[model samples]
Structures are given as structure tokens and as C-alpha cells.
Target: MDFLSWYDWITPTNPFASLFFGVIFTVIIGITVWIDTKKLKTTTLAMIVGVFVTIFGVTILNFIGFYN
Candidate 1:
């Protein structure tokens, strides 16, 4: 399957995969927010960090076939 096909499966067609990815995404976001809070003490900054970290992390995982 190509990237868009895989994206469709994980995003909507498969509930299990969606939930699994959601949990991993949430965990990544939570960790980034926690670490950023320690340094910046700013919710907005922490949220930004979390979003970027999660996006990059998921992209890397997908590239490595972890999400396939």
C-alpha cells in the first residue's frame, strides 16, 4: 500500500489502528508537554512542542514502516 492508502486505513477504516496510533500520539504529546513545561513554564509553548514532536515522531515511524 502507498502512503495515502495506509493513511486512510489507520485514520478511519481501522478502529484498532486508529486507537493504537492515537494512544502513541497522545503519549508523545504528553511527554513533550511535560518536558517543555519544566523549561518554559508556558502552556502554549509546551503545546507547540508537543504538536511538532508528535508530528515528526509519527512521520519517522511511518517512514520506518512502524505504522505499516
Candidate 2:
């Protein structure tokens, strides 16, 4: 199975679990931003990465038919 299928393991949404993962994801990206001294370059790259990640999340949610 490919990676998108992994969310199937979620089975159901648990508010606390989702919150925990959100914090973890935020922390990781925060650290990456923190370490980069080149403000312009890093900020641009970070924005690109953020947009793509958001699109990817939508794809995953669509694939899983989360709204249905």
C-alpha cells in the first residue's frame, strides 16, 4: 500500500489525537524555519512547501472521502 492509504489507519477522527499531530507538524516546520538564517529565500521556500503540503492534504482527504 502507498502512503496516502496510511490515513485509513485513522479509522475515526479523535480530536485530541488530531491536535497532537497538528502540534508535532507545527513544531517540525517551526524548527526548520528557525534554523534558516536567509529570511527571503527560506520564507519563499517555506511558502511553496506549505502550499504544496496543503494541496497534498486535500488530496489525501479526497481520496479517503472524509466528508462523505
**What TM-score do all the candidates reach, one by one?**
0.43, 0.44
| Candidate 1: 10-residue stretch with minimal lDDT | 9-18
- True lDDT of residue 55, candidate 1: 64
lDDT, residue 8, candidate 2: 33
User: For all candidates, what are the clash counts?
Assistant: 0, 0
lDDT of 2 by residue, 1-68 (tens): 23223363364243333434544565567567857764767755665676566556655765777644
Name the runs in model 2 displaced over 4 angstroms.
Answer: 1-38
Please provide, for model 1 over 11-66, each residue's C-alpha lDDT reduced to its tens digit, 9 standing for 90 to 100.
53333454446555666666676676665456456556655665676666666766
Which candidate should be chosen as best, given lDDT against the real structure? Answer: 1
Best by TM-score: 2
